[model samples]
Target: MIVNLTTLDQDQAIEQISQLEPQLFGTSAWSPNAIRQELNAPARTYWADIDPTTTPGNPVIRGYAGIWFDGYDTQIMTIGVAPQHQHHGIGQTLLQQIIDQATADHAERILLEVRVDNTPALTLYTKNGFTRIGLRKRYYQPEGIDAYTMALPLNPHTIGFQPTHA
Candidate 1:
């Protein structure tokens, strides 16, 4: 069950995501404070996939994703799934939800950076039509991992169309 995260889910989201950060992002995981700030940031949307079978009072976040949209462009901020829940389509679902939002918001394009070594993520993005646009050397920080800058152009007419005006 994918749901937009609310203020009430802040602490749980932070706690759960923090637990998965090291495994997902290596040395570049967001701190709890950073998560809090992002959640409060304007023009950003965050969502979580909750375990529907969990007890009513204790919803478990199986995966979470966030994106920042500033009218014309949407930038993916982060996406993480609990290690145990990965490979079960949670990440894909989160990705799709954000993409849907970007399309509905009239975004010209959506962009993101993924570690070059993250094959699963690269595959996921590529399968969804994102194309590599550039590379950011040593973008993953102290770990020194390179990143691939990828983009998905939402409006096909704007991205590759060269209109020959007669």
Candidate 2:
């Protein structure tokens, strides 16, 4: 199930995303401090996909995503699914939620940067109507991997795209 993540969920989200970072992002993984700051940052929204069967008051986060909307454009900050949960449509669900949030906020567009070699992420973005806008060389630190900046225009009347409601 997908749920909005608040400061109350910070520690669990951090631990789960931290464990998945090495497998999902290599050296570009976000630090725990970074996650903490983002969770508390203004105009930022985060969501977590938790196992529905998990115990009450204790969730097992299968994946998590975040975005920042500054009253105009919405920028996807991060999206990661555990290796064990990959290919189960959790990423797609998270992306759709972000898109819905952006649209609801009347955002002009949504923007994100994906590592050049992350095929799965690229496919997910493109399939969701995000177009390649530019490239950032050496965007991922330490590993020095290139990144493709992508965007999705959100004017429904112009793009013929509609955000889904679950």
Predicted model with the maximum lDDT: 1
Span of 10 residues, lowest total lDDT, candidate 1? 154-163
Pairs that collide in candidate 2 are none
Give the per-residue lDDT of model 2 (tens digit) for 137-161.
9999998999999999996345677
The 10-residue segment with the lowest total lDDT in model 2: 7-16
lDDT of 1 by residue, 40-152 (tens): 99998999899999987678888889999998899999999989999999989999999999999989899999999999999999999999999999999888899999999
Model 2 lDDT on a 0 to 1 scale: 0.89
Local lDDT at 39 for model 2: 84
- lDDT of each prediction vs. the true structure? 0.90, 0.89
Model 1 ranges off by over 4 Å: 156-166
